[model samples]
Target: MNNLDLQKLLDEMTLEEKIDQLLQLAPAFFEGANSAGQITGPLEGLDLAVENVRRTGSVLGVGGAEEAIHIQEAYLRHNRLNIPLLMMADVVHGYRTIFPVPLAMGSSWDVELVRQAAAIAAKEAAVAGIHVTFSPMADLTRDPRWGRVMESTGEDPWLNGQFARAFVRGYQGEGIANEPYKIAACIKHFAAYGAAEGGRDYNTVDMSEWMRREFYMPSYRAALEEGCEMVMTSFNTVDGIPATGNRRLMRELLRKEWGFDGVLISDWGAVKEMIAHGVAEDEKECALKAIEAGVDIEMMSSCYPHHLQELIASGAVDVQLVNEAVMRILQLKHKLGLFENPHRYADSVAEREILLNEQHLAAAHEAALKSSVLLKNERNVLPLAKDAKVALIGPFATSDDLLGPWSCMGKREEAVTLAAGMLGVADPNTVTAIGCGVEHIPDEELAAMVEAANSAEVVVLALGEDSEMSGEAGCRANIQLPDRQLELVKRVRALGKPLVAVLFNGRPLDLHGVLDEADAVLEAWYPGTRGGAAIAELLYGEANPSGRLTMSFPHSVGQVSVYYNAFNTGRPKDDPNAQVRYVSQYLDIPNEPMLPFGYGLSYSSFRYGEAALSSPLIRAEEKLLLTVTVTNVGERAGSETVQLYVRDIAGETVRPMRELKAFRKIMLEAGETKEIEFEINEPMLRYHHADLSYKSDPGKFEAMVGPNSKEVQALSFELV
Candidate 1:
């Protein structure tokens, strides 16, 4: 059906029905919903009647294919027009076959792998009858204190933008209209939600227009360019106004300037929270502001349903606003072919076969393997011999909490633990012990671990924050391992056994204690369902570690927002002429982070040859080629992520010290050497000036090529 059909359906609806279509509620609110009694507080708190739920525009979540079918069938029976409910869920990383967290996927630096992971997530969710996934959270975060950093790709706008486009393509493969197994992708937390002050969740974001556009807005734009189906407003405020009700941001900028005609949604309860943000007077004012700002759906909020009709009748809101929102909803349904078959892809039989299938699990395993960053490997201590008597001791030794937050339908019980993975390769004498919990260690547990360490040839300490420690609202001030866990590490170190540490976490942590104590450290970021298996492969040399750090790991929490792409101050710390006491330097810690972005290690060592430029200078539209030879100098084959970064000597405004413009991940044999060439055009050197106009200025530039950001070979060039 076209706009005419949607418009006719809108015309047939009474004011009450049209208003109902603007609200999104949980599945439990529907009488025949799978979890009808799953949640009682939300239903009573919102004061929404059963009838209002039946006519609701969308369902927040569904249990499975059976539940989605039941909710739609029940809702359709009560509707005069038989308009189906849009099934939406927060399928962040995975639906059932869980993969690595978004931050981990970013570390892989493999867009195709990230894309494949998303497609698998879409396939699983779509079969369970989920129409839309709140995924590819494109917030470029610098602060690790924000718990939601796990959801974002990283601190680089360019890399985050690349992942955003990949996710959209993966989730909405081809198009939902043609692809029945794909779900619609929603790029979320629009307008710099990741830059919350103090790195606190739901805190105010006060940034200049230039910074927001230059650093934060690129990812959202890239996702829209890829035709993402929807946009979700953040819970924070922009320029002292809440994003859910900011007219200039939603209507003027996103809808008018960018020309995005897709559905606009509010992050949970964000519409009503505008009253708390001191902008709206009450529910009536909240509804008026939200609709005026072009928010099509208010998730888990009663502001629209309770006050929209009254506001429309009082002439405070135009009826056309409601009509447009309803049309967009209908258009989405039409795209998913829901109007023709409301129960599209809700196949119970097929869902069982597709969810957590062998192929999907293999993809998850590969993702975990590539996403795990080898932070420190001393004296070739890793790639432990399979016949060694290993002692795996820590909270996560046998724990099944491998699947991280927002793992919609993934089961922890199904996760392969570290102990289970070690059993497959190690000697029969290998011992396993949970020496401590995330924040505590018992006396008996410590004793068991010590005894195991005494009898073992090697000790592998598996530790990190629990699944509850780092997702939404999982902020930490210290951003370090708990005191008890650190104590456990010290005890294991005293045993004089070869020690290795594996971290299961979401955010980039301060590795002061653990890094010094462990002989080798692997950042196995909350690896999903197959985390244990993949980690085992990396430890046993079955697979080489290739994942890099997308976000920098701070030396201390004092450097909460440290990143590679930062402007150099006038009295730079690295300047030889500048006095050490007078330069912009920290008294206690170094200016640099413990680990820099695009930094990772592999079992196989890599050697970089001097970079050569095809030309010393080039004009506009001319291409400059910088070629470098990379060789694997070790005994084993491995993949290396070659990063290309550029620095502007002078700009209309001071630019970052190094900005990642392009990157390529290539595999090399034990003794193979490959020449990698990058084509640099004029457009690649452009940046936003002080006046906020995006253009490249004629200037001297430096091109750097290396395995990571810090260690690189540079060549000078002039763009005139």
Candidate 2:
């Protein structure tokens, strides 16, 4: 219904009825079987709640396709209002044909693949009778210690924004109002939840507005710009205010500043948690605070239904605010065509037909291939020669640990193991050994695998954390390979064979020993469902590895705050003579990361020529074009990621030594050369001034072009 019609209906309802319309409760019937098993039905019980919603005009959660159809039919039969219930599900990753976690997808830097994965996920979810998916997490994480990092695209704002738009487009697809088997995409953890202190989940975020705007807000903006249907508030407090009750953030910034018109849902039980945050005195206060803050839905909170009416009746909240919230919910339902055909999405045959289709599997394979970062390939030791007798050793070599966390929709039985993939590509005589269980195994099993390694010409040792080690509630005290796994690798290396180590992980790990011992290393990450096939293709020269690291790999877990973009210390430790002084450098290790952000190696090497600027000086309104020529110097065909970075030599405030501005991934045959250019505009140069204005100061700037942050070709430019 339009606003006029909705308001006309509201005029005929009592204040109690109007307040009830703003509240939503999950149906008790078929509650436990919902995706993730976190959903629960209403207070009075399933049947009672259904009857109550029928009379009260509230929403209920329908379990799946069959249940959704039954509930809709029952509501139509019993209700005078005939209001439809909203079916929701946690469709994280793929609904049935699972894809890689968002972090792995971000590493791919392939936006289209990410879109296809989400599109398939939405297709399966919609077929299952889900109206909305809590997905496309746009949180910008810099801390690997945060377990939720698995759910987010890695730390870059620009890359996160691109992925955000792709996911929103994929889920909502053209428009949810018209498209069949499409669900609304909820862009979540609203703002800066990724900046959780100490990398702990649900920790406080303390950052300046400048940092929030520059590093965290872009993805949310992008999601909104792409017409995301809903937004979920984060659990963390921002600047000492819980995000669930922050009126300035939700009302002023999100709705007013950015013009987000979508339904704003609080994170799971976040509305009630406001009491724990000390922002509310009780459930009544929590309801008043959240609704007044512009939140439209309370996911599993129950505070909205229990306390909102009392709060509104007592004049704690305006009646119009309650009406506005109800209007938003009804508008979404109207757009979904729920009133006309509530059971439109309730088809069991479609559910069986759409989930895990062949096209979805192909997309997952392409995503895995693109997301595999070739961290090191010394002596061109990859694309293992055909018919070569290779030894596959490691706990992960035969294990189904390839499916990373948040892949509940993925089945382990169907997952292809590294051993299986390699055997499929290699000759019949390919040797294999399980050096250690990816998680846990007996010492005897480790010894046997190491013995088998002695007979092979080359060994491929897959290592790193299992699927459960790097997701939500999976925070680690030490970000390194388990001691047992490391020891196993050492024993396997004693066999005197060239070894290639493949890492299957969610976050960056401290792998200094493997770096030194292995002839080559590939940070495959948790490559998702077709991970094995993708790794095998890259290993046997069927595919070229082009992915770059989105996060820095620390030398040790102690280097917790490590990143490529960090402000230079006042006492810079550049000199060898100053190494002993207590400065930014660690006594035992270098300040540099084990592998800098954007660092990756290919079978072929690329040589970067000197960089050139179109103009030596640029005015406030003018832009400059920075160009450089990169040549493939090695003998094999490969791809190189050309990165453009900028440094402000002088600024009103201190600046990071380098910041990534633009990057391009280029493919080249042996001896091929290409000239790549990046445009530097006013926005690229702008930063928050001391007075809080966003502007570029008239000063000297350095433009650097290179393969990664640590190695770069530099040129000077002036912005006036």
lDDT of 2 by residue, 207-253 (tens): 88777876789888899899999898998997788898899999999
Off by over 4 Å in 2: 9-64, 71-80, 178-180, 433-436, 575-582
**What does candidate 1 score on TM?**
0.98
Query: Could you tell me every candidate's TM-score relative to the true structure?
Result: 0.98, 0.93
User: What lDDT does each candidate get?
Assistant: 0.90, 0.79
lDDT of 1 at 31: 56
**Residue 245, model 2, lDDT:** 89
The per-residue C-alpha lDDT of model 1 at residue 650 equals 97
Query: For each candidate, how many residue pairs have backbone atoms clashing (under 3 Å)?
Result: 0, 3
Positional deviation of residue 520's Cα in model 2 after best superposition, in angstroms: 1.8
List, residue by residue over 137-214, the lDDT tens digit for candidate 1.
Answer: 999899999988999999999999999999999999888887769899999899899999999988899999889999
